[model samples]
Target: MKGTGEEVVSLFYIGTAIMLFLAFGLLFIVVTYQRHFFRMKRKEAENMLKVSLESEKNERARIAADLHDGVSGDLSAIKNYLSVLAKKESENKEIFDEIREGVDAALQNTRAVSHNLMPPLLETEGLVPALKGYLESIGAKAQIYFEVTANGAVALPASVAYQLFRVLQELTTNMVKYGNVSKCDINIALNKEALTIDITDDGTPFNFRENLAKPNASGLKNINSRLHAVGGVIVQEEEKQVGNHFTITLKNVNNA
Candidate 1:
């Protein structure tokens, strides 16, 4: 009976040991699984961010194409028809002129919107003229004075011009949307090796870091992406009693 009792105690100790071993094994597996799950989740989040950014660019291109190819063509036809009708109604010239003016305004607005979406001049005429046209168009509407001073001709490659144009457009948009909507100065200078653009606005100070983190601040993202494409760097300077000052630099300019 004593020996039987001792055997029962030994069996109980073995059972307890087995339970502990199983528990530790289960914990190890669970921890490994959790680590893998978290890693996959992080990767998925990064991929989603990339997809969203690319989607925005694709959507912009699609909308620009639709406006340029569809809406602009219709407006051009309407303007032509209005011109013919006005000539036919020479007796009531004043009424026709009024109607013609309305049509002309509509056509002009359509073209402006199209140009703003995708500026053909940027591709054809080059960057400086494109910037001038864009600034002039927006300035007329916003009634804000913009001064662009180019010390030397900015003859950039086509690809570089496109990216730089986008960066400037984004900056101008941000300035108009958040700045004081007053006069802004743009200085473009080309050195022997690099190109630089300095834009200073006379508006409220901007929080660059905070704004860039906001979800709705896609324009800031776009600016970063464009700069990245051109291998450029951006520097923001704070000015007392002045608005946001942005400096963009492109080094080792390579032709596309």
Candidate 2:
């Protein structure tokens, strides 16, 4: 009877162990499946974001081309005609000169708008030169100084460069408009494993994360989206006694 009891106890223990193992195996499979499903969804969302940004860029480029090639050309022709009229008709010289001045101003504005939409330097010279040219172009008008420096250099994909430039542009615009900025510094560093950009400003400090949560933070949201599409991240450093600092990082990118 005792032997029978021992055998029953052994059988019961073995059954429990097998049940526990089967339960754990089933749980692991379920968890793995859930993880994979979430990963796929995240990937799909990123792909959609990239597609949307690319479409926006293409549209901007088209509009810029139209403004430069079509509108600018027509305005130039008109200006030239006005110049000839001003010289030929001495009686209406003042009026022609006034009209010519207006046309010249319009031409300048059109070119500025088209350039802002899609900078030719960006397409031709690359990111650094584009940024420098942008800063120089805006320096006199914005009443703010900008300095750009690089520790290491690598040729970035055009898409990445465009998005990064847009991000910086948005931030600089915000600083100029709201931060009462005086001087801004932009530093770029690249290594085999990562690329980092540090932007600092001597301006009124603002809370980036807090502002990002506000309803009227579209510019900040756009910056976030652009970085996400490029697998980069922007982090605002903790505020000190003065100034604002932001860091952008991209990891595991192929420098080659």
Candidate 3:
């Protein structure tokens, strides 16, 4: 009887060991699966970011081409006409005045082209100052009241700054083209580890999600892509009666 009891006890110990082993194996599998899932998600995010950056580059190239082939060409022709007028001005006072006016207009056109391509304020001052200047310029054109506020000590990395600047440019352009907005508020803040940008407009409400899903929604896609490249995310708020709200959060720019 004692031998039989000892045999039963040994079997019980063996069964408990097997159960533990199975449990541990299942735990390992679960952990491994989670790890792989996260890895795949991260890879997908990286790919999306790469695509976004490429799109932005393409858009910039398009803008540059338009400026060079269209606006710049026109301005060059105007300048040439003015130069010819100046040469003929010695014979006619009216021609001299007309040539002077043409030169002034051409100069203004050149400055406008330069502003559109790359604002001088951005190159001379930092991002904040540049943004302020840009917003003011847009506001003037649209007869909109745009305000900007910045807080905190986080200075952005150049790459991140450029991306964010482009995002803002797109947003402002959309507002001017579609939103019919007469007022806008832009705010930037930085916490210890993150930078936050908020842009709100008093315009007709937009269905952002629907727009994002459309086939040719390049602007929103570009914004999302740029934000991703900068280790940032764009959060669109629920539509309120007032307007659209966009919040962009970027990580590690302060440290970078």
lDDT of 2 by residue, 1-256 (tens): 9999999999999999999999999999999999999999999999999999999899999999999999999999999999888889999999998999999999999999999999998888778889989988787688999999987455688888889889989998898889888899999888867889999998998999999999999999999999999989999899966789999999865531
Lowest lDDT block of 10, candidate 3:
117-126
lDDT of 1: 0.79
lDDT of 3: 0.80
Worst 10 residues of 1 by lDDT: 49-58
lDDT of 1 by residue, 1-256 (tens): 9999999999999999999999998999999999999999977765665456456556666777787778877877877887888788889878877876887787777777767766878778888888998998787777789888887677888767877887898888777777766898899888876888998888888777688899998988878866765678888876556677889998987632
The better-scoring model by TM-score among 1 and 2 is 2
Clashing pairs in 1: none
Best by TM-score: 2
Instruction: Give the TM-score of each candidate.
Output: 0.67, 0.88, 0.69
> How many steric clashes between backbone atoms does each model show?
0, 0, 0
Clashing pairs in 3: none
Tens digits of per-residue lDDT for model 3 on 168-200? 999889999999899999999988778888999
Q: Indicate the residue-level lDDT of 52 in model 2.
A: 98
Local error of candidate 3 at residue 44 (angstroms): 8.9
